[model samples]
Target: MKSLVALAVGALVAGGIAFAAPASAGCQAGWTPWGGGEICDGPVGSDGNFERCQTTGVLGFGGTQCFIANVGNAQPPRVGP
Candidate 1:
């Protein structure tokens, strides 16, 4: 029984790490027009200006046993004082 408990605990820990890895869901895409016309492209901000941008993990699973890992895009933030 004790051994089983240990095994379970180990599995749980691993699983937790996997799920916690999705920690880049920032910015949700908002502004747009860097050199097109208006001129408003700057959503960089970890400690500066930021607008919106997100999407870096499981969003919309498909049918049976579906899966939707990290997609991409929306990334411009990581400043400091």
Candidate 2:
């Protein structure tokens, strides 16, 4: 019984560690860390600049989504033409 309990505890601890690992792991190359997720600059488009976001839940078991958005161009407006 004691061995069984120890085994269960060990499993739980291992699982917890695995689940928490990604939260601290560095983002992939070119990606930057964001609030509990990672993001990176996306390709510029005719409309504007873009940013991509990727989110994942613990152990990637659920609540994973990816999206891109336009953040507008960064150039200042011309004056005194």
- lDDT (0 to 1) per candidate: 0.28, 0.35
Per-residue lDDT tens digits for candidate 1, residues 2-81, read 56544544444334333342232431221112110011123454554444322111112111121222213422222111
Best-matching candidate per lDDT: 2
Candidate 2 lDDT over residue span 1-78, tens digit each: 656544544444334433342333222211112212332344556776454534333222323344555555321111
lDDT of 2: 0.35
| Candidate 1 backbone overlaps, count | 9
In the predicted model 2, the residue pairs found to clash are none
State the TM-score for model 2. 0.31
**lDDT of model 2 at residue 17?**
33
Question: What TM-score goes with each of the models?
Answer: 0.25, 0.31
lDDT of 1 at 38: 12
User: Which residue pairs come into collision in candidate 1?
Assistant: 26-53, 27-52, 27-53, 27-54, 28-52, 28-53, 28-54, 29-52, 29-53
